[model samples]
Target: MTTRTPDAEPLLTPAEVATMFRVDPKTVTRWAKAGKLTSIRTLGGHRRYREAEVRALLKGVPSIGGDM
Candidate 1:
């Protein structure tokens, strides 16, 4: 089991976020592009979203970027 620092939050894959929002993974990607959600790029170039932000969005909270 790997340990993470307090500031190191777990990231969510686009597919994971999609499942929570009942949307397609592609839609999640689009949302990132549109700034509806904030995404972090891995060294491999894949996008990862902050889990807390995604959950907040699911709760009908405004996104940090306020684009949603």
Candidate 2:
């Protein structure tokens, strides 16, 4: 089994993640609800995402027919 990296930071807020992906905050929330992205909840019920996971998702998205 693979071990996790100790140097890795925790999670990012929805707003920060939205800025990273260039999408609206609600989009991040939708992704979490649909299981496309993973998030954790705070005691106040706020959502947060793992940056490494988000980066992996970004890599899988195909560019627009070479236009991107």
Candidate 3:
């Protein structure tokens, strides 16, 4: 018999997602509520984002090549 451990998935907290997009945490929450981004709630009611989804959004965005 072979035993295997499933790989853990990467999940990003609202704070981390905010930092990635340079937005406020509340903005992330709003996006979640607006269905702009997919999010899962923790047992304690905190929102978490999937890295893959974030990456997809980032890819669609055009680079400005400078600080906003």
Measured by lDDT, the strongest candidate is 1
Candidate with better TM-score, 1 vs 3:
1
| lDDT of each residue in 1-68, candidate 3, tens digit only | 53436875578998998999899999989888777888988778888888977776767753222212
Best by TM-score: 1
Residue range with the least summed lDDT across 10 consecutive positions in model 3 = 59-68
Candidate 3, residue 44: Cα displacement in angstroms equals 0.9
lDDT of 2 by residue, 6-63 (tens): 9966688999988988999998898888777878987789998888777766787532
Quick one: ranking by lDDT, best first?
A: 1, 2, 3
The TM-scores of all predictions, comma-separated, are 0.85, 0.71, 0.75
lDDT of 1 by residue, 42-67 (tens): 87899999999998988998765685
Candidate 3's displacement at residue 40, Å, is 0.3
Candidate 2 stretches with Cα past 4 Å from truth are 1-8, 61-68
Q: Model 3 Cα displacement at 31 (Å)?
A: 0.4
